[model samples]
Target: MQLSNIAHGPEIRDEAVAFCLWAPLHQRVTLKIEKRGQWQMKRLADGWHRVEIPGARPGDLYTFILPNGLEVPDPASRFQPNDVHGPSEIIDPTFAWRTEPWNGRPWEEMVIYEMHLGAFTEAGTFLAAIEKLEHLRRLGITAIQLMPLSDFPGRYGWGYDGVLSYAPDSSYGRPEDLRSLVDAAHGCGISVFLDVVYNHFGPDGNYLPHYAPIFSDTHKTPWGRGLNFDGAGSRFVRDFIIENAIYWIREFRMDGLRLDAVHAIRDDSHPHILCELAERVREAVSERPIHLIAENEDNNADLLARDAQGRARQFTAQWNDDIHHVLHIAATGETFGYYRDYAGDGAKIGRALAEGFVFQGEHMPYRGKTRGRPSTGLPPTAFVSFIQNHDQIGNRAMGDRMNASHPIEAIKAIAAIYLLAPQIPMLFMGEEWGSTDPFPFFCDLADELNETIRAGRKEELSRLPGFDVNDALDPICESTFRQAKLQWRGAIHNEPFVEYYRLLLSLRRKWIVPCLADARGHSAKYDSDGRLVCVTWKMGRSILHLMANLSGEAVDTTVPNRKDIILSQGDIAPDRLGPWAVLWSLAQE
Candidate 1:
């Protein structure tokens, strides 16, 4: 098997360890293993430095020494016991067999539950997260998607601002603890998917800028400079990201990965970095199925399309922001910021249901340009839809969930659309029970960068009308982190929406899952005058219809006669629908 230069990070073999570092610009590099003194590294062709230490083993701490007498932690460190600035420790990659025969669950059977390890439980450790998996299993979640865990500088973060791509954040416990979580999740018949960021690194504790030309000034991102994926010294950078993807799947047994913000990954190279990454992952996993998802803001349809050879070009699914935007507008009737492009009406939902993206090649007034490609050719299962996620909820000035902004009936109606639709569905943590706790944007940053983050967050919130910039919660504050943690007991007992979610998920598995494979079998319609959105889905011989009234006032409407009434919530009459009434029935033709 061929290996990338970044693939070998302190590989322990037969009582000796081999260390490899790509330092083409530097004339000399030294391997400084703690307690073992320093050993000069031999410079190889193409700017790589290599050294073999006989006594080095799995638990050793090491750093690389430069000609200027400065020492830095390994860029591809597997474990950083002393945080991001400390020496990288050699961890035992070996684990006992438990989920060996586990081929992950099918993508078609997936109902994803997105979670934050720290915010999901009171203890905020991987083991603590394991204790709550049974609840998700009972809720009928087939997959769990965790936010980024890459090692960052501070004690708490959203995980996007990570410096070390290889190491799991030690704040979440040891790397072994993470392994146990995945192993346990598989034992419960749930697959684990990780969200990974490769567009840029965090500001603090990011030593790659000094060691190598790892970033480019050509393309700028909101967070930082874009990664140099197409310029000089880009081959190694591409390998670095591809290897990181494989490491998570091979080392920790992760079932899949969700690439964060691929629109920022600007690469003009022929075979795009995303395509190469997907191909490498497929090669690494061999015959075992692994899911690859992308969060593309541009709404490019080709991200999930196949090449001429019938090979998947990039990912299995792309996070469908259009669906969420239209639903949010219809539910809350707020047409500000990016929501202005979507009309807050029931017809928008019907359009999204029939065609994949309502904004397909249409000129977007908010951006003053065309935004998305035609996604009608793409399968509905190729898009992941959700009403609320971390970015949509937490990026708000108050970090309010959808349940907090809209009425209970409106929330339930939107929930039914997302869950029962042909597109893949994901639930935010604690969203099942409509938890009132705000998922505010919180991060633990060093003092030097604290004010910058605070000011940036405040400026972003200023775009929303009537929002007080001064009253926004500090992202760097400890209280903000505490406020985001889920109060599981309170939400489960007090919130009635929990039962709504359970019933929807049950119906999804029994009725909707079978029809997701064929996008043509689904159709939707809506009447603006009646304020009603109706969807009809045909699965083999079983036909199902879902009608929802999103208006505040009761709506009188004609109802088609159906024999099987699978599920009905709120007011459902033969010809009239009370405000926010959603009814699901099976029709015989």
Candidate 2:
């Protein structure tokens, strides 16, 4: 078989299969057909040659012959066994998907619910995640952004360290299973946005270096070797990564992709990988709109900017960590890592509302550098804001939640600000009702990768405020996933939390005042010494003022008594709410 000339994913003939092998010093390589037994083929002169195998179709198993004559499974196989040592399964992407014309929700309308497939349910499979879609839909969520599901080694993982780009993590079920989940999510009127990692591959089960020069030794990232986007003979490597992105969106009928850690892509090409990927994806739609949301930290609005042409350039949106860090730390009082820079009473929250980013060009004491660029024109909706996401909850030393860290009323106040703000609000899986689970980081890896992860996690986490790697990877024996599961019954039994969430969702749909910022003046006000904050949400013709106190002590102030009092934080504050107070009112006559 011809290694380089072998038929690839889309450009394939039924009878032709190109076998790829990386001997680095090999003269010639051949493919060994492993249908029941091994069948050797003749070698070519130029390191690769092709011969049509008449009967070898999608299901027939195959391996490649090394220059040393050792045979191994297809290193870049779309499916793999339980571990790296296991057999590589043949997968055909021609499975039926029901969400053919699913073109994702608009950026302004997205209320994302971030979730981990494994810990999302007891089964932790694609089918398992499907069972809870109705809850998310009824909760006013427009999209489901799943954590990385790229196939990785071992039993369970967070899916970020996925090694195989094209394969869905078999630990979470098969390729068809993921397709069914996306199809089912679309059926429930919820778009599925998958989180994909293109910056770097997982440490384990990564065979790209074995078959091709996919990783560049030129520059190193925190996650080891960065992808060889612009290197010698890097055409195939670039195509491989981009094809994988297209595969998930097209093959599984995924509505969009939340590209993980795009800031690390570090491509210096004229047309960057991100821009190229975006162009091709929209073109593939043929008439449908596809979404590409970047999980970027650069804070450069140009990442979502459009060129002279009116094409949909850049990503649909990006994950705004500053907003959450500022608001969450203000409410929960956890000032460890980046949260240390967000202790401006309610001024931080106010700033985030007026501008989508809180730390835009601010000197960050934590990173010891000024972070983010000036994004004066960007709308708040382009950045997904949340009081709690998987990263925030999981990074905790003991996996404690904001609820466990602060009074429930404080959490409610945080919730009110995010839901009432102009930006799209996202909720971690159990964040709505305030689940008590600690989303501690855990991963199942092959022994080689597992040890690397443990050591690497230790080194990386040492920089965090109080993270202990030993405590984080404690075998998941403490029912970490169970604790993270959304206690549906608690939605009713825990009436206060339930009501708080319901009020937010209801207002998100009905509160036209905050629905859109229009041709009017808008700003968030703070009390005499920055103890309380009041935001005026004004569209073209609608306007309402939302107020909340972020301090422990309350002060008497001239709150507008002329307007209609629409909503309050809780029953405890019939007269005045102290810790976490919220209210909405219009200008009185």
Candidate 3:
């Protein structure tokens, strides 16, 4: 895999350990080991400083003193015992994997469950999460998509604002603890996928810019300066990012990675950084199925293209926000912001189900631009659909879930459609039992940055309907972070929702997953009349049909004549679908 070429940070050997740092702007770099003697790093021609310490064992705390006397953690640090501003800890990557070697499950078998480590349980630790793996395995979740774990400043933050890309956040647990969580999940027959943010570092505690050419002046992202992926000194930057992806796959034995916001990653190289990273990761781990998913707002179907053998050419699938928008509007009828473009558009709901995207080459009024390319050529598995994810729920004025705002029937109808659809399905944490507890945006940062974020969040929420800035939760407050935690007690009261999800997922495993491996694009058709949606897919030799009435009133629609009924939600008469009703049936040709 040529992992040696991409190695950075501290490398432990049999008797000697080597430390490497890329500090192009600095002429001298000093390695400061805690309670140990310091050593001057030798400079290389390509801006890298290196030093080897014999008998330097694991559990050593160290930092690099720059030319300006500023101490900073390793850009590729494996673990941060303290926070981001603290010294990096050298970790022994080797672990006695308790589980037998696992090659990962197929992409079609994935029923993903997205979770935030901090809010997933009361303990908010990796080992604490391991205790719930059996519950997930029984719930039919083949993959557990964890939120980002990179080291961010302060106590807590959505991991998108992470600085040390390679270090797992200390707030959750140590690097070895994370490995234990993965090993434990695999033991329970569940794959672990991590969400990673590579577009930009957090607002605070990022020291790469002081020593290396990390950001490009030629490009900018919404967050700030974009990463240097195509500039003059971009080869090393590309290597750093690509190596981070491979490190998680090889070191942590992660089954996959969900690249957060690839659209924000600005790179004009011959092969984009996204493409390069995927290729490198695949090369690094060819023995097992290592899936790479993207959360791109651009809806670029080209990235999810399949080869002649129906294998992904680059990314395995994308988080389809289009389907979520359409389904959310159908359930709640909220038309503010981006939802306005999809509101009352029954055709979009049909297209999102039958095809992969709704805005393919169409003008989106919300963004004031033409969004998305043709996605009908790709397989249905190219899109991952979800009704409520972190962003959709947390970004709101009050992190209100779909169940909190809409009727249970409405939420269940939408769940029935997506959970049993041909596309990959993902459930946010606590969604199975109709959790009403909000998953609001919460972070702990410097006082000044916290105030700035709080004000900005208020201003953004004021634009939404019925939002009051005065009533908004302070994101930096410790109480707000605690408020987002999942309440397991609610599961007992909402057992019906759990059973509903289990039934749908079990049907998906038995009927849908087997045909998905050979499923192709442009093999589905749909018809929507007012509030009624009917879609049919030709999955291999089997025909899967879906019919639903998403409104409060009953709608008359012709039911497909197939006795192989998988599920029927609400009342489905011979010629009419009752309010919030959904029906699914499969017939073999």
Using TM-score as the measure, the top candidate is: 3
After superposition, which runs of candidate 3 have C-alpha atoms over 4 Å from their true positions? 1-6, 462-466
Which digits, one per residue and each the tens of the lDDT, describe model 1 over residues 416-467? 8788777889999998988778998999988988999999999889876646
Query: Which model, 1 or 3, shows the larger lDDT?
Result: 3
Q: What is the alpha-carbon lDDT for the whole of candidate 2? A: 0.68
Clashing pairs in 2: 1-49, 2-49, 2-50, 6-18
lDDT of 2 by residue, 1-589 (tens): 0113443432235765444443343555566656554434454543333345555566555666656665555555666655554556666667676765566665556678889888888778888888888878877887898999877766777878777677677778877788888888888888888899989988777755764677876856778878887776555666666667777777777778889888888676657878777876766665555778887776777876644432337676788887888777767676776677787577777767666677778787887888887654555556678888887777665667787768876787778878766677888887887777677777766555556666666676677866655666453333654565555576556766766676687777666424454412333332324776766655445566767777667644555553356666643244454656677665422
Task: Please list all clashing residue pairs in model 1, or write none if there are none.
Answer: none
Number of backbone-clashing residue pairs for each candidate, in the order shown: 0, 4, 0
CA lDDT of each candidate?
0.84, 0.68, 0.90
Q: Which ten residues in a row have the lowest lDDT in candidate 2?
A: 1-10
Give Cα distance to truth, residue 580, candidate 3, Å: 0.9
Candidate order by decreasing lDDT: 3, 1, 2
TM accuracy, model 2? 0.88
Give each model a TM-score.
0.95, 0.88, 0.98
